[model samples]
Target: IALNAWQDTPLYNDKERAALALCEKLTLSQNIDDDFYLVLAELFDQPSLVTLTVAINAINSWNRMVKMFKPTVEFNER
Candidate 1:
């Protein structure tokens, strides 16, 4: 599935939304600071709108199944 956040959508353009979007992106993209993680954790604490939780869970599931430095064993094998 091609799951992605719709940044340009009007639903996400409100004042408080910019901070929330930044938090999600920072965590999704790279390592985050303690403060940021704290904020993210707090923001995601909500019981509604499970996008953040679902996104993290999906990425982690893919990460566990991902291969690393395999010398082309699956594709270019001899």
Candidate 2:
């Protein structure tokens, strides 16, 4: 999928690439350098950046919970 190989593919624009790069860094618990902060700031305002960080953290929390609990879902036919 394009998302799975976003780095190798050319499907994303500058903003998308920036957001994806931030997401990868946050998800992997990597250090965000000053240059990377400048890149993100160029693409997004403070509020937008905060929102994106919150969203990324929320998703990562959910993923961790799922991996730990291994919850299963079921569907019922009406």
Candidate 3:
């Protein structure tokens, strides 16, 4: 139940919320609020935060490139 309804459940911790908030900003808004940085600072160091942000940006960029290319996906359904 917790896994299924973490957003509404008490199982959702601050760290998880912080991560989700960060991802939401990157994916949806493309601009982060000052509060988001404060939360991130609580969870990660300066270097780690920079690395994580860059990594996420890189992954999003790669996803955009792949989507633009529209390559065929071959999946084996077992």
TM-score of each: 0.30, 0.92, 0.69
Q: Score candidate 3 by lDDT.
A: 0.77
How well is each residue in 35-74 modelled by candidate 1, as lDDT tens digits? 8656656655554335655665676566556644334335
Residue lDDT tens for model 2, 11-74 = 9999999999999999999999999999999999999999999999999999999999999989
**Predictions in order: lDDT:** 0.54, 0.96, 0.77
- Candidate 3 minimal-lDDT segment of 10 residues: 1-10
Candidate 2's TM-score: 0.92
lDDT of 2 at 10: 89
Candidate 1 deviant stretches above 4 angstroms: 1-5, 13-29, 46-55, 58-60, 63-78
